[model samples]
Target: MAGIELRKVVKNFGKTQVIEGISQSVPDGTFLVIVGPSGCGKSTVLRLIAGLEEVTSGEIFIGERDVARLEPKDRDVAMVFQNYALYPHMSVRENICYGLKVRGLPKAEQERRLALAADMLGLSEYLDRSPRQLSGGQRQRVAMGRAIVREAAVFLFDEPLSNLDASLRNQMRVELRRLHERLGTTSIYVTHDQVEAMTLAQRIMVMNQGHVEQYGTPDELYLSPATVFTARFIGSPNMNMLRASLERGRLKLPGGTFLPPIPATDAAFTGRAGEILLGVRPEDLLPAGENAPETLRCRVELVEVLGADTLVHCALPNEAEGQEPIIARLEGSSRPGPGDVIHLGIRHGKAHLFDPVTKKRLAV
Candidate 1:
């Protein structure tokens, strides 16, 4: 396996800059995920690493070699694209062994690798089937098998599971994790789905508007987001943001009261006082009737039941116009339906405060 590095990477189309100076390293045998919204240069970054696109001004390194000027084949990397790019005329076994054949491996060696990959991926049962006769998930597995047999230094996946159904996607996710554990090849996966990134990635690089917004482990990005943008992006149902102001060592909002200065945040806000953004995750808020000393008076607006949990949408008396409504996730067993008047409590220690001007988290 090889470690990959990109230093000051930049990409452009005509006069428009699509990827601004980006620099990151993927450690040997690490699974790093590049995630962002559409048009955010995620795929472009993958292509840059694969040597499919020339860098505008930066260095691309695989292990100790500079491959910026090398061809894709010379980089010793395998890429699996979103659409299963299988040769329709070739059988599954033929498709898996195509790369070995091109590289002039002996016929016996090709057969051995093809058989091993097919068996590992459960494609051994359908080795004689053509690509056109396989299911979407099966075709995706074939594409992966092609990459696996290469035993390349690194693997690049470009949303390979995007075309599958929900159940199939989940199944493939588990399978991919197992495969990565077994091979331990350095991998860089690009996707727009936060769920996929959270489940599969050891570290996630969140991109936005040609730049990286944040890069961290899933828990770090979710629990202590460095910016307001990150707090909303990494969670389900998103995070609830409220306009707040510091008063008497406490945070005062329209419909509720918050904890005093966070033990870790006293230094950052020392002598500073003005508008601040309060961020709280959906799971951090609970039904108020439990009688927590600190509570918020809000009107229940709607309810959405999702298996084991229910999401509560509420309208706070202090809610700013045009701002999204607050959302709370509660146990499905205890959650009330729509229009249920209830008191809600905010988890004090779990609150996150951000500077309204810079959008940076208060150093708590």
Candidate 2:
């Protein structure tokens, strides 16, 4: 398997630019996920790498050779598309071996690779079945098997599991992860789903308006997002961003809640003051007892019970206008209903700081 690299790649359709000048070097056998909102150019980047779409400017490399001008077949990259691009007339076996047949590989070599791919994909018994007879997941596996038999230098997946049901999507995620573990192929997956990006990617490249917002491990993106967009986009239940600023020695929220300076947390903005932000995760806000330190008094607006835990949707005292209720994850047994007043304490050293002007996280 060979790594893929994009050097200042740019793609434009007339006056509308899709991919901006983006550069990244993915190491050999790395699982890199490109994720962003729809129309953010995530899929275009994947297509460019697959040689399905020509780059408007700059270069693309597979291993050591530049393949920007090469045809799709010569790039040695197999792409699994979103729509399950399978031949309806071909049986599973024929579909899997189509690439080998076109390349005029020997019958013996074709059978060997087909068998291995089928067995690995758990499709051995369904080889005689047509695409119409297979389930969505099975058809996806067949598409994957076709790519597998190619034994290409890189594997490109363009939202390959988007057609499956939620349960099947989860199931296929596990299967795909296992497939990567077994093959160790250099793979690039494009998807708008952050969960898929978080779970499958070794390094996630979060794209925004065709620019790279952040590129790092899941933990880095989650705990230390580069920008406010990354902070809001990467986490589940979404991080609560309160409009606040550095006061005499603390952070003051719109609700007039003042959080004392935790040296490490405040060092990044010691002298700076104007408008700043405090990013609080749901789990970081705890249901505190009376007289608890570093706690903000809030009135519960709603409660959502989710078996083991309950989500407390509440509004803090002196909250700013147009502020959405912040959610705090508490134990299922600790139910705080609407209108119930409670104190929510912030976990020490857990809050994130961001600049209001640049909308980027403050490095501490």
Candidate 3:
């Protein structure tokens, strides 16, 4: 296994800059994930690391060697692509062993590696089957087997599970985690799916518009996002943003409701007060009693009953025109019908303060 490092790496195509000075490090045997929206240059970062694309500037290191100009084959890495990239005409055994053949390994050694990979991937029974004869999941296993036989120091996966069905994707995610644990290889996975990033990554780098937005563990990004974009992107159902103003240790909402000073000792309230964006997760907003303090009276617009939870969509009276309705995720048993008037309160210390101008999280 080997650690990988990027020193202000940049990639440009003609006049367009796709990667903008990205620098990060992946410790040996760590599973890192690059996640973002489509066209966020996540795949480009992966290709740069795999030596599939030349860096326009800066340097890349694998272990202690500078591999910025190395050829793809010279880099000690294996890539599993989204399309599987299998030769349809060859049987699973031949396809998996093809790399070994090209490397000129002894026939006995090739057979040994093939056996080990096949057994590990549960593909021993499908060795003689052609790519056309196997299911999509089985074919993907064949591609993984091909990479495994190489015994590369790093593994690069370019949305390898995006083509599978939801059930198969979940199953493959579990399998991939297990495989990584057993082999302990340094792996970098790129995807637009935050769920995949959260589940598979030891450290996640959230990218946006060819730039690194935030880099940290899943919990860190989810609980204490560094920016408004990250707070909205990393969580399910998205975080609810309300335009408000802070003055005299109190926050005034759009509809003229004032919340009590939040944690008198919070750094954000020391001397900073102005137009701010308040972020509250869907799960953090709860139904309030009739006489509860600092509550917002809302009219329910819709209610969706999920298996274990219910999502209540509501609109605040005299709210800013054209703003999206606030959604609250509550237990399935708490049912509030459309047109019903309800009051909601922000859970203590669960609210996030952000600078409206910079969109950065305020220190609390």
Alpha-carbon runs more than 4 Å astray in model 3: 318-324
lDDT of each: 0.86, 0.89, 0.92
- Report lDDT (Cα) of residue 32, candidate 2: 92
Q: Write model 2 residue lDDT over 258-343, tens digit each, in one string.
A: 77676785566667777887888888898778786667788899899998989999986555574546889888899977999999
Residue 323, candidate 1: C-alpha displacement in angstroms: 7.5
Count of clashes, each model = 2, 0, 0
What is the TM-score (0 to 1) of candidate 1? 0.95
- Candidate 3 lDDT tens digits, 1-364: 7999999999998999999999999999999999999999999999999999999998999999889999988889999999999998999999999988988999999999999999999999999999999999999999999999999999999999999999999999999999999999999999889999999999999999999999999999998899999999998889998888887778888788898668842555867678999999999998899888789778899999997999999987656684447999998999999999888999888888888989998877
Q: Best candidate, lDDT-wise? A: 3
TM-score of 3: 0.97
Candidate achieving higher lDDT, 1 or 2: 2
TM-score to true structure, per model: 0.95, 0.97, 0.97
